[model samples]
Target: MNALGALAAFAAASSLFCGATAARHSYAEGDKVKLWANVVGPFSNPSVTYQYYERLPFCQPLDGLVHKPATLGELVDGNRLVLTPYDIAFQQNRERVTLCSKALTRREVQQFQAAIRDDFYFQMVLDDSLPMWGFVGKLEKVAPATPAEKETHRISLFTHMHFDIAYNLDRVIEVNVSTDSSRTVDISEDVTPNTEDGTIRAEFTYSVVWSPTDIPYAQRMEKYRRVQFLPQHLEIHWFSIINSCVTVLLLTGFLATILLRVLRNDFLRFSRDEDAMEDAEESGWKYCHGDVFRFPPNHNLFCALIGTGTQLFFLGIFIFLLSCVGAFAPYSRGSMYTALIVLYALTAGIAGYTAGSYYRQMGGTAWVRNTLLTCVVFCGPFFIAFCINNTIAIAYGSTAAFPFGTICIIAVIWALVTLPLTILGCIIGKNTRTDFKAPCRTTKYPREVPDLPWYRSALPQMLGAGFLPFSAIYIELYYIFASVWGHKIYTIYPILFIVFIILLIVTAFICVAMTYFQLAAEDHRWWWRSFFCGGSTGLFVYAYSIYFYFQRSDMSGLMQSCFFFGYVACVCLGFFIMLGTVGWRASLLFVRHIYKAIKCE
Candidate 1:
C-alpha cells in the first residue's frame, strides 16, 4: 500500500512539472499574437505596443462582480507583478478570466443592454489612453488542427477591450477594429448567448481584421494620446480668459487714470509751487516723502523674503515658457515634475545671491545665518511636506512613494548642486549694487501709526484684494487640479502661461494702488502690508484647493487626503512668498521715485 501511494505522488509531481513547462513554451519570445476587440469607435486604428504587464496592466479589479480567478503571471513583493509582454498576450484568449460580469445574470444582461444604448465604451490604457488601430488585411482562417499542430499550440492575437457606443435604435452599435494583418474572420455565434427557455443571456463578440498604415511614430502619437481633454473644452477656457481680461482691463484703466491724472497733479504741485506743495504735503502721500523709504522692521528677514520671492518668480516664468514651447509634453508622464526639480536646483544661485545681497544691504552681519535661512525657508517646508506624504504613501503601500535611492539622489542634488549655485548667486548680487538709491535716510525713531477703520486694515484689505488675482486663474486651476489628482492630461499650457502673466500684472497693479492708498493715509508700515497684500492671493488658492478636495475630486482615504492638503500648503506658501515679494518691490520703486522727485532736505 505504501509503495503504491509513493508511485501515485511521483506521477502527480511529474504532471505538474510538465504542465508548467508547456505553459512556458507556449509564450516564447518572437511569437505573434492576433488582436481582437469587442467594440470599436469612430476612429478604429488601435495603438499597439509591447509593454510589460507588471508595469502597466491591460485591466484591473474594479468595484462589483468577482472575475474568473486566473493568475497568469507572478507578482514580486506586491510592488510589481512579474510579467513579460509576451506572457500577457499569450494568455489573452487561452486565459478565460473575465474582468466584469463573469456569469451574467438576467439583470446584468439588461444593464449591459442599457449601457450599450447609452454609448458606453472601453478604452485602452497603455501609458495613458491609447487609441485603437483597426485591421484591414485579407482573411486567413486556421485549418482544423492535426496532431502535430495541436502539440505545438500557437499564441492568439490581442486587442483593446473597449465597449461599443450606445445606439438607441436597436440598442446595438456596429464597430470596426483595425489591425495590421489581413486574417479576418467572424467570431463563433455560439460564444454569444440567445434567449431560450425563459432565460435571457448575452455575450460579446471579439473579432480582428487586418489594417496597415505608414505613419511615423511621432505623427501617430498625436492621435493616440491618453486621457485626452476634449477640444470643445477650449471654449470654456477662452471664455474665462476673456472675462478675466475684461476685469484686468478695467483695473488697468483705473490705475492708469490714477497715475496719469491724480498722482501726476499731486507730484507736479508738490515739486513746483511752494504754497501748493505745502498744501499737498500737509494732506496726502506727499507728506511722508522723508519716511516712505524707511527700512522695514526685521530688515534682514524682509530682504531674505524679497530674495526668495524673486527667485521663485523667475523660476515660474522659466518653467511656464518651457512648457509653452513643449519642452515637457503632456504625453510624457512626470516630465513636468522632473523639469521643475532640475530647474529649481539650477536657479538656487538666484535665490542665494538675492538673499545675500539684500541681507548685506540691510546691514545683517550674520551672512552664514542669512544664507542658510534663505536656502531652507522654502525648501524646508517642501522637504517636510514631501517626507510626510512619502511616509503616508509608504504606509498605504502606494507606488507614489519615492524609494530610498531616489530620496538620496534628491538630497545630494540639493546639497551639491542647488546650495553651491545659490552661494554663487549671492556673491554676484553682493557685488552688484542697485542703481536707484533711496532718496531719504531712514529715521532713527519709527513713525507712530494711527488707528484705522476696518476696511483700511491690512488683513481685511489683503483678504479682499486677493480675490482678483485668484479669479484670473480659477478656471485654469480646475483643470490643473483635475490633471494632478484625476490622472487627466493638461495640454493647454499656453493658456496657463498667459493667465500667469495676467495674474502677475494684476497683482502688481493692485499692490501699487493699495500701497499708494496706505501711504497716503500716513501708514509707513506699507512694507509688510505690501508683501502680505499680494501674497494673500495664495491664501485664496488654498481655499479653492479645499473646495476642490471636498466637492470636485473623487479621491478617498486618509493617506490621499493628507498627501493632497500637505502638498497644496507647500505650493501656496511658495506662491505667497513670490507674489508678496513682487508687491514689495513695486511699492519700493514707487516710494523711491516719489521721494526723489519731492522737495526733501
Candidate 2:
C-alpha cells in the first residue's frame, strides 16, 4: 500500500515535469526579451556537450545571475540554461550594439582557436521558447603562394551576431542566427605576442531584426526537421524496412513448411511405431521425449533472465506505440528519456511476476532470492556502467555527468516504489503458481546422447541462428546509431515499430527451427542453447558498433569513445536477454506440443 502511494506520487510529479517546457509568452512592443545560453559542443560528436560558457571567456550578466531550472529529463539530457547578458527589446531593431568587451588571455585565445578548428556550435533560446544554433567561429585553409611552401590555415572568431526573430501576432514563431564573414576578427593577427601587455582585447557585437510571419507557432519546429541528406536517409530507411519484411516472409514460409510436413511425418511415425521402439530402432527427436522436458540447469538464473526479458519486451512495445502516436515530441528535450524512466519504474511488477511464476513452475524453493535476482538482473550491470561513465564525464568536466541529487532521486524511486511492487508481485506469483507438467515422464537412468556434426553443435547453431535476425535489423541499426551519436533527429517511429515486429518474428522463427534441428540430433539441452541462439544477435550488433565507431563515424577522443562503447555494451546486454527469452519461450512451446503428440509406453 505504501509502495502504491509512492508510485502514484512519483507518476504525478513526472507528469508535471514532462509537461513543463519553455513557457510561451505574449510580448508587447518594447517589452524586454530574455535570451538564454544552453550548451556548446563539437559538432562532430553530439554526445559530448558542456555548459555554454564552461570553456569560453564570455561576459556574464551584470544584474545578478539567473538560471532556468532544469527538469529531471533536461538534466539527464545534459542541458543547462543560463541567462545571457544580451539586451534586446521585442520587435525593436538595433544595429551594431556592443554586447560585451573581454580582454582575452593567451589561454582564452587558444581556446577560441581550438573551438573554431573543431567546429564547435552553441545553442541559445529566444523568448525562452525557441532554440537557435550557431557556430562559435570558422577555420579557413590558405593555399600556399609558392609550390614549395607548405599550406597554412587561418582561424577567425565570429564577433558579430545578427538575430532574425519572426513573430505571429503577439507570439514569436521562429528565431534564426546569421553572421557576416566580414565582421569576424582574425585571432592569429589580433592575438600575436607583440600585443601590448600580452593581452588581446575583443568586442562581441550583435544586431536584431524583427519580421512578421503568418505561420503558426505550433508548426515552427518544422524547419529543423529539414535536415541535410534527408532524401537519402529516407531512401535507405525504406529499403531496409522492405528488405526486412521480405526476409520475415521467407522465414515464416520456411518455418511453416517444416512444421506442417516434417513435423507431421515425425508425429505419425512416432505414434505408430511400438515395435520399432521396443527393438531400439527409434531415432531422432522422438527418442529423446523423456529428457526433453527435464528441468534446465541453474533454473533460478534462467527464470530471472526470462522475467527481465519479458519486462523489456513489453517496455519496447509501449515505448514504440507511444512514440508512433506522438506522445513523445521528438523536438522536446528529454521527453523520450523521461518517458522511458517513468515507464520502467511502473513495469517493475511485471518483471517480478514473470520471474517468480517461472521460478515457482521450475520448482524453485527460494522465491525471495529469485525475486531479488530478477530486479538486479538488468539494472545491476547497467548501474555499474553508468557509474563508470559518469565518473569519466566528471573527470573530463562534461555536462553528461549526472548530478548527485539526480542519483539520489533515482535510488529512492527504485528502493521505495519499484522494489515494493516487485515484492508484492513475487508474493502473488509464488502463492498462485502451478507445477510444470510434462507429457512424457523422465527415466530413472539418463540416456547417452550420440555425437553430432560440427554444424549441429551449440556454438555453430548459435552463430547460424543469430545471423538472420541480425540481418533483419542491421540497416535500421545504422539509423538508430546515427541518431544517438550524430546530429540527426529520428522521427520515423512507425517504420521503427514495423521493423521491430519483423525482427521479433524472424528471431522466433529462426530459434524454433534451430531447436527442432537440435532435438533431431538428439541434443535435449535446448534450454540454454535456445536462449543463447536468440541472444547471439546482440553480439553481432556490438560487433557492428565497433565497425561504425571506426569506419563510419567522425567520433574521436578518449572520453567520446568510452562513452560510446560503455553505453552500447549495456544496450547490447539488454538486447541479448530480451531476444534470448523470446527464443527460449517459443522453443519451450514447440517442444511441448511435439512431445504431447507422440505416444510413449
Clash number for candidate 2: 0
Task: Locate the minimum summed-lDDT window of 10 residues in model 1.
Answer: 69-78
Cand. 2 Cα-lDDT: 0.84
What are the candidates' C-alpha RMSDs?
17.1, 3.1
Residue pairs with backbone overlap in model 2: none
**lDDT of residue 240 for candidate 1:** 74
- lDDT, model 1, position 517: 85
Question: lDDT tens string, model 1, 227-285?
Answer: 34466677787877897798799889998877658788877766676755455426677
TM-score of model 1 relative to the true fold? Answer: 0.69
lDDT of each: 0.60, 0.84
Predicted model with the maximum TM-score: 2
Clashes of each: 32, 0
